[model samples]
Target: MSQPPPPPPNQPPQGGGFGAPQDPPPGGFGPPTPPAGPPAGPPQQPQPGYGYPQAPPQAPQTPPPAAPAGPPQQPYGYPQGPGAPQGAPQQPPAQPGYGYPGQQPAQPGYGYPGQQPPYGYPQPSTMPMQPQAPQGRRKLNAQAAIIVAAVVAIALIVGGGVMYAKSSDKGDDKDTSAGSGGTEGKNDNEGGEDVGGGGGTEKVPSSTSAKVLFQVPAAEVPKKDVWSVAGSWLTDKVYAKSGVSEVVGYDPDSGKESWTLPLSGLTCAGSPEITKDGVAVVVAEDAKRTKANPYPDCTEVTAFDLDTGKELWTKSVAPGGGEKTAFKEVSITGTTVAAGSGLNGGAAFDISNGKILWQPKVGSCEDVGYAGGEQLVAVRKCGDYGNEKYEVQQLDPKSGTVKWSYKLPDGIDNAKVISTKPVVFGVDSGEITASGATDVFSLDDSGKLRAKITLEDGKYEHDCGVNAVHNCKAIAVGNDKLYVPTKQHEGAKQYSRVNEIVSFSLATGKPTSDRADAGEGYEIFPIRMDGSNVIAYKNGPYDKGSQVVSIDGKSFKETKLLETPATDQVRSAISGMVPKSSEMRYTGGRLFMAEDLISAPYSADEKDYAAIGFGAK
Candidate 1:
């Protein structure tokens, strides 16, 4: 046998040398290796302690006996193969372009020396970093958006509500009538049809024929100098010229005579006053024809029905022994009617009947007595001749019992008491000084003075030369405001044009400083306070010429000026020359004025008076 030809290169060695461990050349038994570096690969036997099995020397090599069946064993100096077991199936030798143990594979398009994968194999993809929401930011933005929208919505809603409320309020204040002066039955600019004669005494026009809509004439023969006038709403009539005391009803719209109630045996010196329920209470003297000595002895307090001109009741109040006495001033409020005797204090009566309620003795020569809520305030002159001073006394409305008295300061020539709650007094100097003053005093229920307010200190001076405090002609209180009017002096002539009207706050006693110059030749009478409007007469640029002026009580501004033309007149008659006396009065929604002219026919000596009515336009 030829020595077996030195076993073929790849075959195992013969028998007994199998265990001979002369270290094989680095690559284990094989043909002499070329200089191309030891077989390009990891070492066949792992380093000691690497946990790899030792390889047999001269052992048959069949692809290096595939690495143990399970995961390949870990090599020394390198971490165990990821997910590989201590002993496992060995992976095939890395393909071209693949990496050796512990080495990364070459990128698909790149080559490491000769290592490279076959073309067309896909490379592992790198996943993009997953996007993440900013921490807490999304939730925070959602909340902020909601809050912004809510704020905007609330602002819009509030603004819209305010606008709507303002519009509704404006609509409520608008007046819907044609114009301030539009007449009910006439075209906008056209005047009413003339109904009666232009001048001379023709027949008295009937209500249907009268151009004037509302008028009240003297029910009884008119007095020579009428000082005061009063009206009753229940009866729709007026009591005029006290002493003659005529009660008349005229159409509120046409001024034509409606009815007349005559008081034959009565005379009044003061303005007739009406009760809240519409009864007329007047201080009157017995008719001249009925009693010869009617001055003091026959004086009586009379209550009359406004509707029928019927006397409701009468009560005679005379000093001891039925002595001749005169009751000067009479006033009526809600529940009581009171009269002040010129020299005696006052007496009150039940408004429901004519029964006497109370009679309290006051000082001598009382100027005026006023009836308020449940109290009576009287102004009287005290002391003896020439040195007399005035005093104000408070009395119980129901019992006529004296509550208290206040002695007025000296030098007070004349004084008037206006109201009770916030008592006001208008006192004039006894001297020739043009200065006058108004003093406000607060009083308790028992009549003690609580506070004193002096309204003005100097002479009354205005553009028209009338001093308000000194020459105050009229003072009235309404809606808690005091209205004082002073004569406007134009040189020697006292005219309404120069008249000044001033308002004062009753509670504070401070002048409102609201002054209105009513223009030249117009007199202002504080007629009525309706809501915020004050109704006053703008009388006499001339006798028959008058206008109605409505003032804003709050702003003291003139709002409405209404002109009413008098009926035409004929020439030369005494009546034609004697201008009509126009009077103005106001109620809830209406203003009424009476135009009366005493006429004497030109050719006849006879005298007659014609009355007409003028309604507020």
Candidate 2:
């Protein structure tokens, strides 16, 4: 996994796990009151850090005879350059290897421990060391833990699940509609018309400010147990969201429920990218849950028309006439739909028909997962349970042949594919950071390593789930660069913290002074790439509402696109839906946030919405 921190504004801070803070419960849409600090002083220039310049040396000063060279008088314990804080207790290095301060080791030999890897790969430590973490970030760790615990306790006692739902509401939603009208084919909306000058057909409205178009209330849960409803997309004619055992299409502007395609079982996985012809696929179980089998295998793949709510095809593969392969994930590349599973290996199918394109031969190696879009990349696992190895292979979409493969180093517990076209991914070695990955790797077209970006613990924020290889958020790759937001820090205003989105060149793996400020009390997170621009979400403060902004990829200038309402009712409804934890989609002057799962609410008065839509007229 490769992602970052907790909530902003009303939400509690995140818990510290793996050096970086893990995701915490949802908080207020506005920032909480920070602790009071010392008296104000003259503002200092920003110090150089990774992807930024190095700090200049102070002029040689004449100290009093016998005076000690005390630490610099900076307040927040944030060290600027190479030197650690003066007089601070010295801490020993955790791992000693190729990457050390001023150590120029020999070129790495790309070989695994016992054999020639499918593709030779150097040891993980050959990567560069991340910049020293700020002590200020360290201090937040303890506070975040305390805040998260308190928030959780309050949720359990008060019986307000939505309040604590901020912490773990990562599940999808169930089917049901309220106050929606209209049916399929009645609307006049047409197909793709890429507006807003980007990759998708997202139109930029004249006014950035927005109003709630409509909302879908949470459906009653069966047996009061959580169920996955994890899929959402925006086509020209419809805004579709997955529900319990069904997929619903709604008019994008009017929020009218147009049509519904019911399913036999729950939707477990969904293709993030829809075809240019308005088609997408989702993985569902073959049968409904029963008393004898509360859990059903996710074995069915269904492709449907996003515009018309028409099912194009539904297919499943039972390898060797054995049990049906239970797939955990699915992705799309061109006309091919790929699904992977650690248990049954992986298989590909034609998007147009239910015909099988290819299926893996029985072997020790299993296709654990895949990341697909401009290309198809599979994450394959081999060896025994305790001692496993992983390989990232770029596969031909139609043929399912490996074009290039890169073997990950030993001791890597997990990895997530960040981008397919540029072949970028993140690796977690446990020794570095616990929250997903500590380093990101970019590969050249030949599958050779290009550059590695070290996400210093607690410095950058992302949400790459522990298991899903393609389920990553708050991170974007475009223009041959990676864009990630920095952890929140003391803002220019009193008792306020802010964060900014920074870019790293994939070619050089260096920070390029490219930063987009999130402003006071606001944190900006990259959602995805639009054309050459970065579509970002800005979490707002108590009185202000969250916003969607378009960041110029080159100039780093921000264009505000959509702003939600700031009223108490609307803010509370929007507060719990963070971009990383929830299924959030924005395009054509509209933004929709849907829950990944749904369950019974704690109290009668509490409102638990399955999805909410907002638009800027």
Candidate 3:
């Protein structure tokens, strides 16, 4: 009988095994803190490793120093990354490659006998040595572990799971609406104050200190930002990508014009996120690149004044970063600014002056994230694909040493740090792009599991888009309430179903009060917690009728936020799902929502998109 052959190098399994690593839970957050990081760029299956034919060891000389006087010379017999520059004697798949450090080297093959091929590549010779790893005392065996990780990264890059995960660093842990429940005390509304309902097209007020508006033309704005970050609020202005490789800030109060920082040729890796005082952007120093260089030829990252376009400092990836692939996610908190990419693990820099702080020693193809706050970065290290264990570590943003780590509980999807303060951890049971369940744990920064918010059926499911948590993982910690989503199919029309937002009290881990149901056909998602309210809405491209609904923490009153719709491009981007520019956002006590649904700019003559801003009336 004929049998099937092995998969291509660095390829996912032939079966249905790949899944989104960081899909969020209901309301985007839920019971029990599950480790959360940045969004897993594109879900990929960990590839299978192969082996090389073994060769007899000649003799072991005192292994060379970590940093050889020059690049360590590859012995005439040893194979290296990319297989000895092609056409070299190919190692056969006779024995398993080596694994685990401090172990004897296999009989000079690709790996220990039976070891999977490194990163699923045809038994490449040796794993590329990490430039930053210690040289003097480290043993040759140490490279074995790193070699395995590098192989996994290669698998990730080829598999298309680019970005990994990151956590939001909103401060403080006070819970105002602590206790309340539902019919069984699951939806208690004890915290609802005396605020009356603002429904029926009543105009919602805008703050004098801030406002929201879209930049002209859809082609100009950045494609997206970090999770939940349509735009950033720093100082008195809200900043976002407006033009091609340009960032613009507007006053949050009156929607007045502010400063615009333009990068002629460089591309914004992703939308900029705020640091303590400045906004950080990861862009290429040179727009043009080639195989010798790479896309984002230079991952030159810069920090700029939130109020002015002045440059604060600049930093680039370390030397020897093979591709120096452009960074995709950047974060700034306290005095540290860190960027992550498959090219560089996690590079943390000093915000005061662009100085390299530290970096992780991983392949130039795996995703890493600044997953926690209080100066913490998160990274996920996976073994072979057949094995379902993922090792997650929290590292000091300043020093790349592991402060702590744990094996993600088995039988769950990938896990990453989602929130640093109040340290909420999240785990996915399915892919975010489709339907799945997210289990959240409330753990301290030290990795202690404090609480778990279990749902009615222990999962959040529906017709999820790319990220299941799109509207399911909303955490209202300030109000001591956690919000989750569920769809009730009461009518025949697909739009006739109502998406329910169930609020739970942090004090009891149960529903706090009455669940708020979006009008039929509308799927209301909580964008963020606005002080005493949860800002919820259904943004749809070309669905001119979506509304922003604010549910008060104390009164549980539903206030329909009011705003002006600007342009079709902005409308298309702010449709809530697959936002092209992250146009509609909420920050600094204000909620920004596009009032109209339209198409992307298809014609030469198109109106710039518009949105409405609502705040305390």
lDDT of each: 0.37, 0.61, 0.38
Clashes of each: 28, 26, 92
Which rank order by TM-score, best down to worst? 2, 3, 1
Q: Give the residue spans of candidate 2 off by over 4 A.
A: 1-203, 222-224, 431-434
Candidate topping TM-score:
2
lDDT of 1 at 315: 78
TM-scores of all models? 0.50, 0.72, 0.54
Error of 1 at 402 (Å): 3.6
**True lDDT of residue 322, candidate 3:** 44
| Residue-by-residue lDDT tens digits, candidate 3, 404-437 | 6644433332443434445444444332322232
> Native-vs-model 3 lDDT?
0.38
lDDT of 1 by residue, 339-411 (tens): 7654334567787788877564433344335534324566656564345565677766677555777665444
Error of 1 at 424 (Å): 1.7
